[model samples]
Target chain A: MGVVVTSPQFKDNARQAMADAPLQRALGHVRKNFIERRAAAAAGLPEFEALRDSARDIKNHTLAHLDLYLEEWERKVLAAGGHVHWARNAAEANRAIVDICKARGAKTVTKGKSMISEEIGLNDALAAAGVAAIETDLGEYIIQLRGEHPSHIIAPAVHLNKDQVESDFRRVHTHLPKERDLAEPTALLAEARAVLRQKFIEADVGITGANFLVAETGSSVIVTNEGNGDLTQTLPKVHVVIASIEKITPTMEDVAQLLRVLARSATGQEMSVYTTFSTGPRRPGDPDGPQEYHVVVLDNGRSSMLGGDFEDMLRCIRCGACMNHCPVYHAVGGHAYGWVYPGPMGSVLTPTLIGVDKAGHLPNASTFCGRCESVCPVRIPLPKMMRHWREREFERNLSPAALRSGLKLWAFFARRPALYRLATRLSTKALHLMGRTKGRFAKMPLASGWTDHRDLAAPQADTFQALWKQRRETR
Target chain B: MTARDDILANIRRARGVAGGEAPRRAAVEERLARAPTGIIPARARGDAAHRLALFRARVEAASASFATVADAAAAPDEIARYLRDANLPATLRMGADPRLAALPWAGTAIEIARGASDGHDLNAVSFAFAGIAETGTLALVSGPDNPTTLNFLPDNHIVLIEAADVVADMETVWARLRERFGKGALPRVLNLVTGPSRSADIEQTLLLGAHGPRRLHVVLVGAGEIGRQD
Candidate 1:
């Protein structure tokens, strides 16, 4: 992957993340805010749950008819005097955008927050071609200054604290006075606005990611809380939209259904502050808008996901609710996942984009508490998908020798119910007798991983299956 | 094969269907033409008073401010009053919208500038195409009448929402767009703004006014008892 991925080092990264005090402190905010706000927003709308069903159905229908819808969207875009460039992968997508900038003689380009842009490493590509790319989103700008990728999807700099951001601003913004009061997020935001505002006016090309692409009107929709996306696409002469193929929806009404669940699940807003729909470049007699419009639709392994076990993943609207509620994500924060995406969604998707051999550890990191799927707006079975990755890893002999032996040992007993039940009963009886006084073990013979952190309760004389059978017969 | 052809071929190969299947073609065409409205929130369907109340509540909830006026003639005065109250400049930038140009700006002390923003103006105003009650969103179409720049590139933005145009839900707004602009077609841009700009990038603390307007003030004109689907 052109985007430098440490996903293969996820285990080591997660270990280091748990020990980093500053990151741990920053992640506390995610724990406090997203869950309660989303709960309140979802509860406020009586139709919210029903709307999720509608959203899921719409995406399902779109994915089933992806070819026809893409054709219709392309035809409509051409009719609207817009150009559509097809990209088979990240390299093609980046080339299409850079070529557009080169044709327009664009020295600088302003960018809205786009995970696809990050996935394709667009900034590095643009730099290689001698074009400057300025990130206009406040979080993206902060991360761009720090030379970091986004830790979280929606909140790019969520892994950063106020002091870290303040320092970043001081380091980059040299023209400002040294002793000025840059002590607050508010001040940091104001400084970013002033800085990016200049870039927006000077930039010759604007690039943004589409939240959804409407096939009916050939429009690309962007939902943002800050108005950065609006300015990014509006002020520049050339506007280039980079989006994946799965973002296509059949109609505006279908988009409306998805929009209802998107904001509430992401940031707990009824609607994001700005939802702008752009069909093409500036129209005849239009006073202001982009003079030229181009859309770069990227495949990048998504078509393979369409009719496979992971087809449900395409229904995701990138709400970030999964990571927000994921316990493992909360412990290590988003950076430990070490890719453009993080948390439960990343666990499943990473293995697909990059091979399971590289990102196999991500799936095993989950505790499978099911909070992600329960809160998912489109109801993608994230944990189930992760399990699928784990199974595939085992089948491909990618698992370690010890783990393989342990699983094999368990599978042997699992196939023989009578012997397994007798063996478990004898082991439980022996453990119960040995630990009668303590009632728990700080260490076990074969399981040091569980006992390392906390004590393990000793099993009773009878197994749960035996106890259940006795209770039913007694009743 | 071209990238488009390869992608379509891959999708068809996985989906187990050729691209020319009549049933799939008819399904997509039907959905596009009919544009069926999905589940609308219960809060969206209400009486005139309830609609206005919910609109105000949701707008305020989004951290935006709105003032009600009896008619369009009072809109400029409202903008002037809002600027004065917020300790902002009394100057305003706007486009050539006939509805706003016809407003009685001479009745107020505010100075007015016209044309698109080059990122220099501190304040601007625009006429909205419709006001949505479900989310308290103002949908504005792109044109010389109401330049898109006035909507985003300003420190302060004041929008005029005609009460008669305020609708019950987003679905209503979609229906109106189809009727006015024609099915499967729209203006180059249609902006739906719900609140002032904000970001929660630093430590998950949400602060209003990021890159767009620091303050968004809406002048809801003739808002009393003016509600209907049509």
Candidate 2:
């Protein structure tokens, strides 16, 4: 899909999405299904918390020493007979990939599911260069056909329903019978498979994302439920792996720890159906594999995060667990977050990558529910991190002046316990008087955003601070 | 050699501030120290056999194959029979495994190709040194007998299992693997195959044959012996 899924310009698109009742209903169904499935998977494992901690430790340790691991990983990969390239950012990454394809005179490029590639807008770049970039992941292919950005990290088209898919298929596949039935999921799947199989066989360059880079062996681990990742990595003569630099681990044991948590958190599977680890190019006696292997490691604002307070953010394995559990993400989905990554991770990551000016509103989207933090396998304090970003945005003059002024005034009063207590008491009394009977405001002046969709209840006459004072005096 | 050294050097550069490595003996000792000193907690509830059976049932439910064998000695013959039943070629490029040397299957007339060289050969038999009952996974460590290619290249894969090696959970497997190989050692490949190679790439149709083995056969020798042997 195009990169416009939930641009900062998404208020208008979100309004449009809200207006479409059917689309909202479809998203609701999908949200509930994933939420329930994730809960069930988590409930079944007694060691889930322990696993998460271990996974977090592994990731943190790797990221903490990422440079070392990456260098070692590249060495092993090269030793295994693979070539490595470094890209400073998205443009460089895209250029390197396109150049490789051009060098090969590649006409068709098949891709596995890689959010990094999406972040770099690789397909559009390839297409602009007159190369055909086909997304082989079923969900990815569907979104690609619709010319939209992925709405979810793991399930890219989670926002689209069967009917919408049927419509897209019919619109695109003009060669199909005019009276063809697109109602069945199976039928839709069959159609997609038919269309993709031809592309897989004909593709000249295959590109994929690496789940983990093993420093000990120089292997790129790709875990997929569908074998498409294997095809995308092996079928074509040239295989290009576009992965974030943070994906490296020191050893297979470290990879194992991460793998244990990844699938269980993402789709609730003990392990994904396929976990293929490719080491270097095809060996001398090998058969039916890529002849050339190129791994492009993209830094893209990640290196800056090292040894910083946001260092914990690099521990993310892109499992999409935090997004799956986030309430705001469930309501608005990935597009609402407005970047390559979404959910709690996206809220923190997007602002860092694109700068707060472009994503000033993203960090404010959360309700501080703590569910994202609780569910994050890497233990990233996502809510706190977002707040940190918000603070940075304000300090850098990225936030609107009014918001900064209001926050400054609030902080001033909050620091003075007496003034804070007095102000809250007065505000509560005023709110109570405004809604004496209903005890709720329909549209408060300063809280139109909160009251637009739902009512905000007035606080009790006596505040907690006031009650505490009374109790202490009586004692 | 320089490439390897360069990689190590880069790592040293990246880890500019060395987080002092805990002594190897101390690390192991620390773990032991943390172990319960009192009466060990009651053995985790449920029969080991039942847990394994239930796990196998779950794996099958997820569309994977599972088998239990009495020992590694019987792996080759069971694998031979499975390949024969599938009507696959008898000449199998197999992974390197010292255990296969003891399997007296000369009468089976099956040709065995061994080592990493066999990775891309379409027909091969591979032995998982261990199987995780929790996920129905076969852990194939690269050695003389277990070649990395045997796990990745073959269109039809036969994984032999020893009942004694089945672990109840992934954590236990990790602990054991680490204890055996240390932190720095790694096999060329450590394939954890849960099922036959399958893909839903073509419009999510769930095609069984994509890149890896189209069929997976597990030769479970003695269904009742896993818990008892371990």
Candidate 3:
């Protein structure tokens, strides 16, 4: 893979991320912006919850019959004179894309924001094949200039401040006026738009990601607010869509259901500015648009996830709502997760794609506040999936020795209720008496990791079991 | 084995079924043949008048501008007026749509250009196939009639939507599309544009006119009622 897997050092990565001042400032935006906007959008529509359910069911049904849907989609794509390339993994997916681009002798290709492309490391693959891919999404463009992956799926440059963007623009875009006023976000946006517009017109190939692939009509749908996706796909001679197998929907009706919840959950817009459904190459007598249409249908370990514990994860639409609502994500930002995806969804999804041993910390990073599942448009039961991963990690002896011993020690007493109650009662009384003066512990043995960040609240004189028995008997 | 076969085989094996399951195939074919509707929002269940108002409200809320004309003939004047009021150029780009061509642009001083845009035009107008009221979205099909480029490559994109084409929900738009394009088929590009181009990529602050049109103005003709009746 072109991208480095930093998931193994997730703890160290998170520690470094927490210490970065600019990153902390940038992460403040994720907390301040996404949560309120999503809540407002959901509150505005009465059927928002029902729409989420419908979206989930549509994805579930499509996945259950995924083989049929994929075959049907491929047949329709062929019927429409479009090419379908099946990729079993990331390398194959990138191979198909590079071959398509190289066959046309493309020097430069403009790209829309697509997580599938990131997952497959397509840009790195293209570079190796002597092709340059220009990211057209504004957020993607900024991070691309910095030689970084997207911090968030939808908001790629959410971890960047305007000042940082200003410097990046000044540093990279030297041909522009050196004294250009780019202190404001608007000026930076104008510059990027001007620069990318020429690339859009000049590029030989255009690659995009699909939000939904319709099997009935053999169309690929892309939803974008900046209209960059349209420009990327429409301007080039060849339009290549990179999407996973689970993106397929049964029909346009199902697409509508998903779209209804997508923008609301992601950006709080009633609808994105542009949602384009492309069937095939430019038709006969068409004035503009691409001449060649190709879709790279990738499995990438998703097909193997079916009928498994991670099957619910396949229904995810990549809306980023889970990350937006996640407190851990808000604290560390997406980079700490060390993958294209981050937050609760990544916690479950990352382990499956890259082995559980590598991504073990992602699942354990969650606060288990259940906000992600509550806000998930498809209701993927994120915490439940994370727990499953933890179980898998422990069963394989992947967790630390201390954690395993602690768990085993607790389980030994928990199996015997009398011993467990006595142990808890004695421990709580001893700790409460010791901490009675301060009512909290700033430092403690074996728990300094937790206390270092914040003082640990002292335990009470009695366990919850004893308190519950007393209350029930008195009642 | 080929990648396609391998992937398909893996999925089938995981699901504990061969590709020849008649029931599964039938279910897939049935869903594809009959694209059924899902739970449409109650907000879209209003009358046509309410639909028109909601369409205007939602479209405006999406950061797009619109004006109502008494008839199709009045659209050209309104278009000119909007352009003049907004201080935009008098030149307009469009396709050879007969509906737009039939309008008497000779009465105005506006310069009219024809065919799809090559990214140089500042103002462009395309006729929308449908206007969905649920999210104030405009569905424009790609062909010679309304090139997809015009929908994205202009500074000011002005679309003329007939009152009769306005629908309450996206599901209805699907029905209209199927009726026109036939089942299991679609145009090269069906663009559902709600507002003008915008981006919040830098510091989560929204900026308009990013890589696409800076302004999207809708001219709804015959706006008093839903159908052709005055």
Candidate 4:
């Protein structure tokens, strides 16, 4: 929210990331680590597959009867002395949060990492209204200082290196002595800690995103390694939790089952360091906690997903497991998606949330690689969902006219086996003729983007369908 | 438009596909009634030693320090020495547990505070209620003696642990907690401290302390019946 990088579209962002040698190298290194660690963690448990299936079924059941669960959640929260405000969309959610801040006369707001806040762009609205919003999460704070959106959901500043952070710190912390060495990790942390301590004490309002909402107890769960979340929620007088309505589970047992998969899939840990749950405002005899607890349940296009084809997408716990395993996400990284959410799940959800006009390029970013779906702890059929989005985009006439016509022509022939076989044979002959050397096409009429990065291998003289026909005739 | 109208209008717009009856609610009561009361995995009792070793390796990997003591009485002195060696002051806040409070430390120069106060003055020491061997986690329950502030506000945290209380897995630890406190019970704060506060936010560089304790020291007490024999 500090500064929007509006110059780059999705294509432009992808090109830039691909061209940057350092970023590509870093992506390669980090992506391998995540994939390898997750596989090792999954292999350790025999019931991991069964657990995924069960988790998926539970999420599906809850989402199918979301209205009933939501009502039950609202009643439980209110009974626990907490207030639940329902927001229809981003605008309503943002306006409601700002209004709450205004009523409390809040000047400074501290926040724990909540993707819902990012989805609503709440900080931008708060800053415009003269309220200083501070990101308490270390990763979030770095990105906030850099004036950029989070590139990765879990590790926001995973793309940055030490020197970049050193420069950012020097620019922000002018009070520090110029001679003070910022080369080491210790020094950088000390500087950030000193700065955030003051913000924690001064902030009047605290906001956080819930990892899970236990409907039975009306408690919002936050899992983090650093204790910044605890400080963010406890230090302020008024606490606001912005979460999607689908985050609620029936009971703590359901929460336990989800947590079993959540941490193991995320960072290969048995459990995250801190899994703190808060029911409501500070009770009597409590020494320190928020006085006013407000939970803003933002539907924001998710409720629409409940009974629709994309309902399974709601089961995502935002663990970043699917993104970590995605081939395209590894190649292009998160910024290429050009939205709040990115990666495989982002491809399906973004188009649905923002409409195809804004995010039509997302679904095409995938290779239909089943890696993401295979690794998903909740078993979201990501590739199929992406295909659905592509289908919707074409139906809405959102795609370019030429591309739509090309798809139509291909579909026409694809339906007729004889015409499709004939077309394939002719194209194979033409490709062989064009390739005089070992099969590699430098440029193609329709696929310039593919050839621009690397040469595409030319097809053989005989198509697979033609070979099948010849074999049958000979037999 | 009124507030209710505005809310309803937003809901209508956000709703995806309508016209279908709501799905039938699944019967959770029947499932819970038939579900197993416990699912604790069986392991050899000798495996506790191996689990403790693995837990230590993980804690070290996370960049925390651990030292095994012969007895709880030796822990206070050893901790005082560690603080002194680290250039930290000897002032400490002790938990309310009588076993921890009774440790004789006449030879040690450290001054023990009776209860939790502002941790800004110096180091705070407390006895962990239980140690989880699975994730190298220490459970801290707040009571009259164990003020939650000692867990956070301090720069350095030193925890005393009994070797016998170390459980081999998280499920085992949870079972113990359930037995101690019934289903409806929850403390104001149930802290599961795993290593010291760490962050990789700044350019993906690992920083030991972002906001919480800069250093975490664990004194594993192997005394009396709790001591693990070599």
Candidate 5:
């Protein structure tokens, strides 16, 4: 795997995350802001849902014809005097990028927030090869300063409060006056801006992740609120774009449809401040742009995903809506999923990218509230996919023996309706009689996990089926 | 097989395609050839005057400064006023865009330098290829006429948008682009800038001028009921 997988220990990570005060304080921002802003933005647009359907259709069309589109895009890139390298995995992708920087003798490389770069661990790889990789995105830069992985995909530092960020800056930037009022976000932003401005001008190679790679024009599109991506690609001598195979869109019109929904879904904005469509490098007689343009096309297990049950995941534009509206994500936060990705989308995708065996705990983490699917811009069935992961886990016996045995016992009773009804009726009657004095039980047999947090409500005399039968009989 | 061939083969296998099927090929080719327009919002479907109004309102909403001029010849003066109002440098960097070059820059004392941005210019101007009313976006195509660097390097970016070039939505913008840069080809870069550069990454509090221009002032030229030309 490109990044280390602590996905197997997701339960422990989630437990730790739930108890972390600073992270919990930080997650409150995501919970309050993203939902309201997105709702307001969507409510203001009458065609928002219709546009989502259109965006989904376009992505589906592209993926179905991905082979042809990829071929066309490659041809167009080559025609436009750009270089395209195909990578089977993260290692190859990193190598291709490192070699490009080396060939240019790039001492420093400025980066625009690319999840692909994170997935490939390009920073460490570049550092190993003696190249300084500078993260120009504010969120990425902060996390990079802390030697931490991004929790949220879109807002990488969504896990940190302003105080935490101020401390991080203070710790790293010792040359600055310690007593400078780094209290406000504005002051912090200004500091980062001043710091990164020099790096942007000095870097030899610039790398950015593509939101969409247009097959029609051979353009790699990046949508960002900050203009960091534009400057990163424009000022540098060499520009490198790293994107997964599934990022392809067939045409500009298709891109338009996707872009309409992307910003609204991601950050609840009409459009991100900078939506750049970069074709080749600089043209003849053109001044002040990259001299060389290189695109590293990474497969990294996505091709196999297209043919499977998880193909719907490929339609994702990385808007982070699925995770944003997710109740489980809100509770445990992103780091709990314990990989490059987190939340419902990560649960489904991590299994495919890494493997269900390692990431089996992710799908089990969801509460199936279905908020993720409802807010999904492309209408990806995130919960359904997570269920699929659970099934796969069960099929492969990746689930614990106790869980398997419990399910087996339930299945034994469920196979026979009379036995199931009788068993449930008896249990309910006993519980009702036992807990008549109290409405709930503080502890219950064989269900300590449920009772440890809060008391389970005692069942009434009648089971749900019995109540239904009685109602039907009386009516 | 090479990685590319292997990946394609895998995709083909997963999609249950033989890779040479005529219907699939035709569908793929047709979609690319047609470049079908998708669901454009009702808000973007309005009269010329209405769209211009919407464009101004949206531009302001996105935290960009908007100004209207009577003609292209009035752009430089308007730009000069904007720089002066913002208390920015009188000197500006620009490209060889004839529309911009034709502006009566001599009317103002602002120093004008040509070519592209070297990351030192405090202010830069570029003539937009088109503007989208739905999001108040400036679609700038890269070339010698309007180098891409001028769009990002400066602290204040003053874009000269002809009122006539403002379109209803992004779809129309694409159609216009296809017409300008042939089918399946584009300029080196096409930047769709909505307001100034901003970031919410610092504790998710919105702050402008994170890396790009802190001030994005638009000079809308040639007023009146200017309908879609294409």
Candidate 6:
């Protein structure tokens, strides 16, 4: 893979991310904006919850018969004169796309904001192959100029402020007038639009990610607010779509159901500015569209997710709701997750796609607040999936020795309920006697991880079990 | 094994089924053939006039401007008025749509251009295939009639939507598409445009005109009611 997996260093990354003032300023936007907007959009539509259920059922049905649907989708794509290339993993997927671009003698390629492309490390692969890849999405363009991955899935540069973007543009785009005023977000958008417009025309190949691959019509759908995706795919001679295997929906009606909830959940828009469904290459007498249409479907360990507890994860539509509503994500921004995906969805998915060892910290980061599952458009049980990852980590002995022994010790006491109550009673009494004056512990043995960040409140005179038993007896 | 075969085999194994299991295949085939409809929002359901009003309201709420013209003949005057109001140039780019071609451009001083956009035009117009009232979406099919480039490569995108073509929901739009294009066949591109180009990526601040038309002005011909901007 071209992109480095910093997932193993997530704890350190999250530590640094927390201390970065500018990043914290940017993350504040997520904490305040997305939640209110989403609530308003959902409140406006009475059928929003029912539509979420429909979206979930459609995905469930499609996955249950995925093999069949995939075959059918491939047949329809071929019938429409489009090529479908299957990749077992990221490397193969990149190779297929690079070869397609190389065969067309492409020098520069334009790209819409596609998380799958980032997942497969396509831009780096293209750069190594001597092909320039230009990002067209406004947020993606900002991050690309700064040489960074997207902090958020939908809003790529959500971690950046306008000043940072202005500096990045000034630093990289020396061709433009040096004294150009980019004080406002609109000015930066206009500059990016003007710069990328030329690239859109000059590029030989264009690549995009598919939100849904309709099996009935053999079309790939992309939803965008800025219309960059349309420009990316329509301007180039060859349009290459990079999508995961689970992106397929059964029909256009299913696509309709999914789109109804996608924008509302992600950006709180009734609909995005552009939702394009591309069937194949430009037809005869068509004025403008790509001459070659290719779809590279990457499995990348997703097929293995089926028939397992992680199967619910495959229903995810990448709406960014889970991350937006996640308190942990708000506290430390997306870069702290240290991978392509960063939130509740990423916590469960990262472990499966990469390994639990590299991404074990992600699932453990959640507080189990359940806000993600509540806001999830497809109703993916994010916390449950994270617990599944924790179980897998324990099964593989991937967690730290200290945690394993702690859990092991707890399990031993739990098996003997009387002993558990006795041990807890003694510990509560000792803690109460020691910390009754302070009412909280600023420092504590064996719990420095908590005390280092915030004071751990002192235990009461009795444990919760003791209190519950006494209350029941009194009642 | 080839990537395709291996992926399929792995999925089948994971699901504990062989390829072409009769029940599974039948289920998929039936779904594909049936194209079942899910729960559509009640907001899009109403009389045609109410639906058109809803379309206008939603479209305007998305930061797009909407206007009503008496008929296709009045479209040119409305288009000219919009360009003048926005202070854009009198030049307009379009594709070879006969519906738009039949309009009397000679009555106005606006300069008309045709074919795909090469990223230089400031204003472009296209005819929408259908307008969904549920979300105020405009569906434009890519062909000689309406080049896909005009939909994105202009500063001001003016879409001409006929009142008769407006639908109650997206599901109805699908039915219309299937009838026009036939099952399992589609035009090279079918674009569903709602509002003008916008992004909230910069510190979560909403800004318009990011890589597409900053202004989306829809001329709803034969639709009497004007939409209110939220």
Candidate with the greatest DockQ versus the true structure: 6
What is candidate 2's lDDT per residue for B1-230, written digit by digit as tens?
A: 33333433344445454434555334333432332121111222256575566556655755655566666666666666776777777777764455666677676778876654323465666666666666677676655566554664567777766655666655455456657765433343455677776543222234564445667776665555433222
Interface RMSD of each: 0.7, 7.3, 0.7, 4.2, 1.0, 0.8
The per-model DockQ list reads 0.89, 0.17, 0.87, 0.34, 0.81, 0.90
- Judged by lDDT, which candidate is best? 3
Per residue, candidate 6 scores C-alpha lDDT tens digits across B136-165 of 889999999999999988899999999999
Evaluation by DockQ, superior candidate among 4 and 5: 5
lDDT of 1: 0.91
Ranking by lDDT: 3, 1, 6, 5, 4, 2
Residues B1-230, candidate 5: write the lDDT tens digits: 98888888998998888888999889988988988888878886878887888888888889998888888877778888888888887999889988778878888999999998778889999989999998889999888899888888889988888888999888888888878888888889989999999998866788898889899998888884333322
Evaluated on CA atoms against the true complex, candidate 2 attains a DockQ of 0.17
lDDT of each: 0.91, 0.71, 0.92, 0.75, 0.89, 0.91
lDDT of 4 at A472: 100
Q: How good is the docking of model 3, as DockQ?
A: 0.87
Q: lDDT at A311 for candidate 3?
A: 97
Q: Give the per-residue lDDT digits (tens) of candidate 4, residues A1-475.
A: 4224322277888888888776675576458667777788778666678778777877876665555556666776776678888887777888889999999889999998988999889999998888989998887888789887777788777677777778888998898898889898778888888788778778899999999876655778888877788778777888889998789876665665677688788777656766776777766656566788889988777766755789789999988888888888888887778878888988888877777788888888888978889989899999999888888888888878989889889999989988898888898999988885868898998898799879999887789877887899999
Off by over 4 Å in 4: A1-8, A433-458, A472-475, B1-62, B67-74, B94-107, B114-122, B162-165, B168-182, B220-230
Ten-residue stretch with the least lDDT total in model 2 chain B: B35-44
Tens-place lDDT per residue, model 2, A1-475, is 3375345665665567667666676667546655676677778777777768877877776665665567667777777677888887778889899999999899999999999998888998999999999998878888888888787788788777777888889899898897988777767766776676667668999999989887766788888875677667756788899998888876655676677678878776767877767777665545446788899988877776776667788888887878878777766767767778878888888878887788877888789989888877778999999999888877888877788889899999989988898889988788778788898878888788899999998777778788788999999
Each model's fnat?
0.96, 0.16, 0.95, 0.32, 0.91, 0.97
lDDT tens digits by residue: candidate 5, A178-205: 8899989989999998889889999999
Q: Proportion of native contacts in model 6?
A: 0.97
lDDT of 2 at A260: 67
Question: Candidate 5: where is the Cα deviation over 4 Å?
Answer: B224-230
Worst window of 10 by summed lDDT in candidate 3 chain A: A1-10
The CAPRI-style docking tier of model 5 reads high
List model 6 lDDT by residue over A183-297, tens digit each.
9878887888788888989999999999999899889999998888888999899999999999989999999899989999998887888899999898899989999999999
Poorest stretch of ten by lDDT in candidate 6 chain A: A1-10
